[model samples]
Each structure stands twice: as structure tokens, then as C-alpha cells.
Target: MSNNVLFDVPGPRARRTSRIASIVTSVVIVGGLFYLYLALEAPRVTANGTETPGMFDPTRWDVITDGRMWNAILVRGLLLGTLKMAAVAAVFALLIGVIFSFARTARSKWIRIPAAVLLDFFRGMPVLLLMLFILLIIGPGAYWAGVAGLAIYNGAVIGEALRSGIQSLPKGQRESGLAIGLTPVQTRLIVEFPQAFRQMLPIIIAQLVVLLKDTSLAYIIAYPELLNIGLRQLPTTYGNRYFFTFFFIVLIVYLTVNLLLSWVARIVARRTASGRKTRRTGPTAGKDEKVGVDTAAMNAVMPDSS
Candidate 1:
């Protein structure tokens, strides 16, 4: 039996009951879907003289493969506009996050207090308000306002994540570095930060997920991001009828990007874990070199006797 950290595995009766429940749930879901299909179709299931299409109309689905439509919408709005903003915002956010996190953790209260206040204020504030504030400050129609808004807000969140990661490390780590004659700043930058970063990498990636999704808020300031593109195209190109099909494409793109990022995070986490394991095992490998050095010293000392 495999041991799970969270919960115990079900026994025979419990497993059987679970299986039965799942089967029942599946039947109910299928029945409900079939009922919905009938309901949607019944309205226009007839050869009514109306020109309007029904919910399950095959003609509506044809829009999914409209290459010309999707090409224009996706290329500019999704790839160029949305992705570009997310990339710029993410980079700036990560940089600001790291800088402020360092400041928040600094020995000096002057630096730490301001950093803390800044992080707390931005993090607690609504992203919409932040976007509006930046837009007002920088004037409207400027793309940088949107990017700056996202960066500042997400940066505060990311900084908190970093600060928590640093704080979660054992006190012994800091003490050990100090005992080795390193100053507090050096100890933090050298010994503590690297390990904390490794430990907090998953959290950092999760925060990036939030940041990516938050890019949609840029649309409030008329920034032509993914959601804004969808909004503009919805009324102009297809109207409200094809709304689902249009946004479905956007959903797929978001899912693809975030899934790719998650995959990268997993790969990095594995590499870091393996690296730590190798470091832990390195001393044993060095023992063999120590033996070779002792043998060479013994041979040199006994050379005259030979």
C-alpha cells in the first residue's frame, strides 16, 4: 500500500462506494447535457421561417475555422499586444520584486520599513484602482501606464512572496554564515538567498500566473491586450452571437502559455533539486582525492629507504 502524506487510501467498501458514486455522477451529467441539447434545439429544431441561427447550429461552429478572422485577431491582439505587455510587465515586476524584497529584508529599518509599506500598500490595493491611478498620472492612451501598473502591483505581491521565502529559512542558516565571518548582507546575498530562491521558485512561478492573468486589467485603460482585442472584435466582427467561439481561442492561448511556463518551472525545480543532492554527495567523492594525496606524501617520505 502506498502511503500518502495527506490522506489514507480507501478500503474495499469505500472504493466500491466511490466508484458507484462516480458512475452515477457521470450518468447524471450526460443526461443533463442531453437535456440541454434538446432544450436548445427544440426552439429551432423546426424549419422555422426565421433567418436567425439556433444555438446548436452548424453554421455558428464554422466561425472556428475562419482563418482570416482568427489570423488578424490573434496575431495582433493576442501575440503582439497581450503577450508583449505580459512579457514586459513580468520582467519589470520580477526585477522590482527582487530589489524591494532585498530592501524589505535588509538590516536597516529605514530601508525595510519603506519597502514593507510599499509592498503592503500596493498588494492590498485593487489592481483596477492601480491601473486607473497610473493612467491618470501618466495620462491616457500610453501603454507604459498599463505596464507600469501591472508591474508595481504584481511586484509588491512578488516581493512579499520573496520576503516570506527568505524568512521561512532556518535561523541556523544565517547563524552559520555569520559564524564563518561573513557580514549580514554577505550572508544573505551569498548563503541564504540562493537556497531560499530554490525553495520559493514554485511560489514565484505561481505568482507569475497571477501576473499573467492580471494583464487583462490593462483593458480598463484602453490598452489593446488579449481581452481588449476580444472586446473590440466581438462587436465589430461577429457581434454577440460568436462570443463563445472568439473567447475560446483566447482561452486556449492563455492555457498554452501558462502550461508552458509551468512546465519550465517544473524542469527548473528538478534541476535545482538534483543540484542540491549532488552538492550533498560531493564530500564523499572528495574523500578519494584525500586518500591519493596521503599516498603521495607517504611515498615521498619513504623514498630514501626504498
Candidate 2:
């Protein structure tokens, strides 16, 4: 009685087999996790006859629970430092990205070629190396060095994202704009870029997550970002016995920020997709608007004029 034919419905035996396989996989995963916990939770004997704490040790976690230590240093200082640096970098990166993208798409070979080379060069360089180099060029503890490094590297990446988005647009778009007597520059600016940005919004935001995480690299330059602060506290707080615990805290912070960015990207993607669908299905939004033309002479010259 059913018309569905794309994929055959699984039989009872097949369902049972899948259930068994899933159960086995779950058991294996749980067993592996328990083994990992046992391994990392093992404590070491220190030189002073005291047992050095491992990841699961309660003493190592007191800093996170101590209200004064946690709120005053980690929350107020280091995290704010990280966010401030990332915010500055993100802003400049976006601006630079737009400029470089325009340059890459320019009419002149002189502009496009150099823009392409610069984009490729920065994109090819490791972000850490750039940060280190910039720090050396500037000075230790100069916050703007981290900002400049992140912006330049990520700006190039973002430029490529925008460029690819623009290039992915239908050729007919460019052709029709030209057919309408618009110059190439005018066509790209007025007709193509808006749609291209909508298409590339998700990718651009994902790049921003990378930029946020890369802010941790500021630690190497001795800027008081989250990771540096955590590492600095590691010696006194945990006596260097709980390296993994401190790192795990930093990892959680990075993960939470990136997760939030991804959530925002998803929301934006949904809205953009729905808007595109509406434009496709509904009346074309101003795209069909045309100036009125005079009809008096044509009507008079016509054989069947009203």
C-alpha cells in the first residue's frame, strides 16, 4: 500500500543487528573513557615525600572555587584581556578583509595581482609565527602586536572567504548587470556584493571563531590573556602538579566562546536562507522595478492605436 521506494525499510533482523552494534560501540566508548580517567587520575610521588596531585585532585581545583581568586583574576583580568584583544583584532580584520577583497576583485591586474599575493602569503604563514614576529618587531607586552598579527593573518583568510563567495555567484548576475549598462565596478558593488555577503556570512563567522581562539597565542608575547594568566597561576596554585587541570579550564573557555559563535552563525544562516527563499518565491523585491517610459509617440505611430 505504501509508495516510498528510495530506501528499503529495515527488517526485524536488521534492526536487531543495528541495536546490537550500537550497544557494542557505546560499551567500547565508555570503557575507553574510564581507562583514560584511571590513567590521568594517577598521582605521582614528589621529592618531598608528598603525593603530587593529578587532574582529579581536589586541591588543584580550589582556585576555580575560591570566589576571590576566581572572580578577581580569571574573570576580571585575563578573560577581559582576551576578549578585548580579540574584539580589536576582529574589527580590524573585517575592515582589512573588505578592502583586500575589493582589491582582489578589482578591474586592474596591478591591484588584483598584489592583493592575491598578499592574501596568499598571510594565509600561508602560521598565525603563531606571525604573532611572534610582530611581537619582536614591536616589543614585549605591547598588546597591539597581538592585534596586528591576528588581524593581518585573519584578514587575509576573510578576504579569501569573501572573494570565493563573490566568485561563486552566478555568471548571469555579472552579465545581466553589464547588460544593463552598469560598469564592472558598479555592477559588483551594487548588484553582487550584498548577495555574496549573505552567502558567505557563515564562513566569515567561523573565521571569527578561529580568530577568538588564536587570541590565546597572545600568551607567548606575555600579554595577560586567559591562558597566560592560567599558566602563571599554575605554579603557585597547583604547584605545577595539575597542568592538565589548568589547561582543561582554558580549553573549556575557548570551547564555550567558539560554541556561541557557531550558534550565532547557524542563526544567521537560517535567516539568510529563509530570506533567499522568500525572494525566490514571492514578488521580486524591487529587482523588477523599472522607470516609466513615454508612450504618446509610439501610440500615435501604431496602426492599431487606441
Candidate 1's TM-score reads: 0.77
lDDT, candidate 1, 36-77, per-residue tens: 877755534336676556566776567767777677567877
**How far does residue 7 in candidate 2 sit from its true spot (Å)?**
6.4
Note the Cα lDDT for every prediction shown: 0.73, 0.75
Model 2 RMSD in angstroms = 12.3
**All candidates' TM-scores?**
0.77, 0.80
* Model 2 CA deviation exceeding 4 Å by range: 1-7, 46-49, 72-78, 138-141, 171-187, 282-306
Off by over 4 Å in 1: 1-17, 38-51, 140-142, 172-184, 267-306
Q: Give the number of the best model, judged by TM-score.
A: 2
For each candidate, C-alpha RMSD in Å? Answer: 13.3, 12.3
